[model samples]
Target chain A: MKQKTITQSLSWLHTWSGLLFGWVLFAIFLTGTLAVFDKEIDNWLRPEIPAHSLDSREAAQTALDYLQARHPHARTWNIGLPNERAPTLSVSTGEQRRGGGQALDPETGELLQVRETAGGGFFFRFHFTLNLPRLLGIWVVGLAAMAMLAALVSGIVIHKKFFKEFFTFRPAKGQRSWLDAHNATGVLVLPFHLMITYTGLVIFYLIYMPAASDALFGGDREALNRALRGMPEQHAGQGRQPPQEVAGPAPLTALPPLLAEAERVLGPLASLSIHNPGRGDARIEVRPLLGNRIELTKGQSMVFDGVTGKVLRAPAESRPSLLTQRVLAGMHFAQFGGYPMRWLYFVCGLASCAMIATGLVLFTVKRRRRHDGEGALGAALYTGAERINVSVVAGLALACVGLLWANRLLPFELAQRGGWEVRVFFLIWLATLLHACLRPWLRAWQEQLGLTAALCLGLPLLNVVTVNRGDYIPLEVTILVIGGLLAACAWKIGQPAPERALRVRTEVN
Target chain B: MGLAIATGLWLAYSGMIALCLGLERHYKQVWGRPPSSSRRRALRATGWLALAASFAASVAAWGWAMGPIGGLGLVSLAGLALVLVLPYQPRLAIGTAVAGWPVLALATLAG
Candidate 1:
């Protein structure tokens, strides 16, 4: 094959593979991008959920008492202890009635807080898998990440001007405009792209390549886990709790003392988890979130043997290891980089979506032209693939952004807010796919892109109207980001006919 | 809890299977001749084993900072870097430098 043949084949491969993974990639990028501000958003969304409140131990125990009362025979209990990020403590009793996990309140044991939690960690969780069941979302994304890695490799292999095109972006010039968009998205945010893809794959490396364990670990995941599970203390249970009745909550340690000692010992308790609270074995563990004034924390658990108040094994405190992981966390989360980095990542993420978006558009662009000589069977197959691309990419964005629209419209006190949020997301996406399928190619692109742009542009206004933040409150950073992106989209979708842009640029030259 | 994790497990299973299919296609596309059917089968079998191994490693890596998959991310990032170098060998030295350094810095800050 001629070099041109190689280039074309790779381009063919990149375009199609990328289109296949585009929606998932966009979800991953968007969610992952938002996940960079996971903490900030958590802070923003759940303003009612107090920060630096009392650790979850007292709360966890209080929750545990209720859950234990509800289902004492549960084989196991898991308490989602809370801290700075989420003040609401949640408790899960084992085998309550069936396998289904039951929810409980932290304080007062009055079934604390549960309404369609669209805010807390919902956006964070929504990324990668669109909050699908773990297996479904993870696999879809893992496969996409693999495809993305392949596309990245093939994209590099095929680009003739890899270096010359570095940092070169020319606005609106036919396919050069498209190619520039691709190169700019890929290269300018090269670090973000590379880091995200690599980290994304690594984030789920074992799931994607379990063989690495056998070859790498020589067997026995437990021992390997021992090496890595940072705080062995967390796993070592606070001695066995004897049987307990609903004590209607007893005197628990005042959170203020715990906080002070916790800070003195563990460097400001970022979070607290209490198991079997208000019992003989009621355990309280104090730990830092991002440790005070010293370093970004990779949490350390000093489990207090509930009855004795003895510290458990705050083990695996390797400064080097912790620091390395923090950086990885930083790169992945975009926390260390702050607002500028956040915006950079957000843009990069959008660019990543744009990369997929443009790549998907390019698929149709290449196909719509008069096929020089490809056969009908080949054309049909190609056309079918384009159809899926249109529905999946544009449709998927419609689903995601539409969920935000849904959040506004959905009854706030609805019993299943989380469920409804997810449902609306899928429903919107599904509708888009169906609409794309029903429409002509050109119309599908224009209309869906137009709606997406409109939705994105209007997101901030909707938030302002629904959430009713005072004008005194500056623009929510997230809303501002969305507004900018939506405007960009509206511009892209509403750009004049290609011939016009070409004629204008050509005439100018 | 274990059953809930099974979803992630199945995901691993599907990815390995798809990877086999993808690699088979990729090799065929590259070499013109199809990879031997038996070889593809072998790759599938190996892929399963790799999937299982990586799963265990990930579980182990949990909570350990550069824990399970993060290490893999580091390595894969490196591998992908090498793959991208093929089309621009002259720029490799500079390219790797430009790419590799930030990761190194992140590793430092993360630690």
Candidate 2:
């Protein structure tokens, strides 16, 4: 009896926790899933950047030349080498807050005419940040992740016939079908779900569990960071005198030799950062590419004197704890995996999303039969939940596809173009919410899903007309096919029930 | 390599579905009668063998570290597909299991 009560209470906890945060969790999961292909999306968005064979040395030289001409006496210079997905050299100076960067064509060193759009990077940012204020969004996402963990644990505790029901699905049985799908998807990918949520929390451990660092390092964030990363604490340009004269120091040594040396030590280099450039106290930092290693933290790096191109410091050997943390983070972010692993992650992510969606739908389906005609608060709650279900599930899908349409249709020179695309997403979602409120729940679902399907299916044609790019047509067509199938499912869902069908037939007779 | 792994995964998935249906209770729901005891035993054994073959094929395709992860992913996907298929087409599901053996053999030989 005691164990039974514990299981019952756990069941209650799982249901409530999942219901309360299901919509936000769904959005996060969908965006994060899309972010697995962020680099490909970036390439598709910037059609002007034709694919090119990456020559890291040449790319680095172009970036250095661009930065020297642009920010001759700037405090810092960062250059990102061209890679497989993004075949362009990206150079930026100053801090991220003072955003000034451009993508240079790898072949010509000329700036590409790429529109100012966030592309897949926007979804990547929204995954964690939710496009809100930085600290607030991180805290909110972290809380949701914690809630997901709780739900996952309670769900496992409550499930009795876990393995027996692994391959069970009885369609058209209403709540039973939903429950079966939820159980099957959830149990099958339970490992992946747990790993993703835990690592997501760990990624923002500083924000989520700041008390540990505060107590251990006396609230010195940098010191705490250095300790956690297992690296020596070395401030940039430490104990250096400020330059008095306006004239800059002599031209810095060429980056080719330095890059070659850094590559020799640490495989292929990803990016190079020059701090205090053109000053006597200048230093260069080189970060290695993420190449098929299961380590999560950014790859090992080397520091060198800017003028002499001599190695100053090699990366410290990470402690076991640090290495474990990095591995977890790496698995969660999937930086080490190639294309197959990435696709696998994407599919698993989709399965997780399906699990959450089915759970939410099952809650209402189970209750609707018991409360449909009851003239009580229960029915009212059911109606409200149904509306929310339609709007969140189908409506968000519509909004996402709508964002892609906005991206293609919006003028190239439109002011704040990226902001407009996000606005389109929210506006469509808001419109669907209003529509769901006004229309019958079933009708609302059909309409929104149908719209999403249409938009997804039409995206390729829109792309061809607007960008005239044939390279990405195959991918767009695949998405369209998926959308078509979703639309068919929506249509089926909107059909009348057996009882309703019998009643209509009798009336017609 | 991709084709061989895909074929191996399908064979394993079909075998899992057949094993599930070999039980008297689930067999009645699908085919309106319990399977024969001997047939049930055969089905269960076949399922285990197919899964073992799938593991070997996956390991051969990907290395030791990635093979298990890939195999797990394939199982999940196949399980989902089987669930979706079993409700409406019970006979088709069993037939798929029988057909999968030859395909698996072909994939292995080709590799």
Candidate 3:
């Protein structure tokens, strides 16, 4: 065995680790980018909610009136206010604060007959969880995020001509072009890559690294959460008790004034929940919209007395340490700076996906040249790796658009339609892997990318035939642009072979 | 706000072009000649100045808190656009940057 220099060792680490985790990272990045417009996508998925310009207070009152009449005995009544981005008021009755809501037309106060679909929330969930069980998915994604951080650091360490090749890129040179693109995208968007990855890990910090929690709190997550909220530890083991029935139902206070006061304080409201609705001891908790600030106020709320409409507890100001954590999480969440900032995050995320995809392709391109020198086993492994690369990259993209197609194409009255949509997504992805394994490499890439392009380009027509709404023009336009790009990529893949690339290089020289 | 953001993006693009041209290899690639030391120094200085102005515009558009974050993204994307364009259309890359001066002036007056 020969001694290896630090750069050589780290270079080896970078290549293998990146290839091992690159597929998962690509999925995470692609879905995270889509999650940037989750609300808009949600709106598109459920087109029953028409776009409207309703005042928040008026909408809140309407939701209150509706909930009061229908769910008078419910323990908690939640009302999701319509906003500029999502113009659908939702009211749900449940023991929990969130989950299982019904959409309502804010103008008519009637329940909307919306079809069940997976919505853009699937992407947001899969971004962090990879469609695995909740805890298991988080751990898997946490490992992938760590691998990304490792790759970024080692990639910088091994690149000898960092500054000299800052803006260098040469097309039509095959392997060199891939390396250049990998370097350019990775380096140019380095800040976003680092910030997004680090913050993603920070979001589940205690779960990923529980040593501090274990050492201090004996590994009791509930106790740690109680202490963080400044709650007394004596009540740590006691779970939330269902609200006891009062002697008699009483008239609740008018919600418009409370909504006004809350709006004055919290900027714009997203939703409000009333505990023990119509009971004498009722309480109203108002939560602000997510994008009002860079710090995620996920659990922050203003509590008010239901009878007197007086403030019981205003939203707590995060301490410096908590604020730092929240801001970092918020950066990854990207719910601040309105649409423009979200667009920036989306572009950077696409670049990140491109960076990972290029790195994966570069691995195979580099290996293909040396495969003949290696034995039969190595050649077989190389072939397997190449097929896996195609399936993971192009396959996942096809599955994503296929999910949207399923939302529209599937039977509207079908039971559990959302579940079926997700199943369609996975089935498409699996089918792509099989196709890639069976077909020739170029044809596999060309066919899958071409199908994805056709699906994306055809989405507007599908929406028209099924949903028949003009509100989602922006989403359709964006899909069309992506389709055009994918078509270009498919065309390029079909045109260029290794021999042609070699010939072009020779001609240039 | 729209004018401010447009100015920010244009200046960021122009700044990245200046910085790219300051590098001797990129300079030769675009202009078919290597830049002298003084020319390169001037280009680098101009690049930094344009970037600073772009930061100001970003701040004007998004305010102090989110300004720097968005500004960095603008500059990075501008650099990325420059890199991708230089390989395929080197003349158009520099040509657009050079043409941005009038647009920047119009944005300044309107803003």
Misplaced by over 4 Å in model 2 are A1-4, A68-75, A95-100, A235-261, A275-283, A305-310, A372-375, A500-509, B1-68, B90-111
Error of 3 at A368 (Å): 1.3
Give the candidate number with the greatest TM-score.
3
Instruction: Report the poorest 10 consecutive residues by lDDT, candidate 2 chain B.
Output: B61-70
lDDT of 1 by residue, A383-476 (tens): 6666677767667766666766776677778887768877887788778777767875545766876687677667667766776542313335
Candidate of highest DockQ: 3
Clashes of each: 22, 1, 0
- For model 1, the docking class works out as incorrect
Q: In model 2, what lDDT does residue A187 have?
A: 88
In order of appearance, the predictions have TM-scores of: 0.64, 0.87, 0.95
lDDT score, candidate 3: 0.88
lDDT of 2: 0.78
- Report the Cα lDDT for candidate 1: 0.56
| lDDT tens digits, residue span A66-130, model 2 | 78887887787888887755665788876522124677877777677877676778888889988
lDDT of candidate 3 over A310-413, digit per residue (tens): 99887878877778889889989998888888888999999999999999999988887767778889888878888899899999999999999999889989
Candidates in order have lDDT scores of 0.56, 0.78, 0.88
Provide a comma-separated list of chain B TM-scores, one per candidate.
0.39, 0.78, 0.91
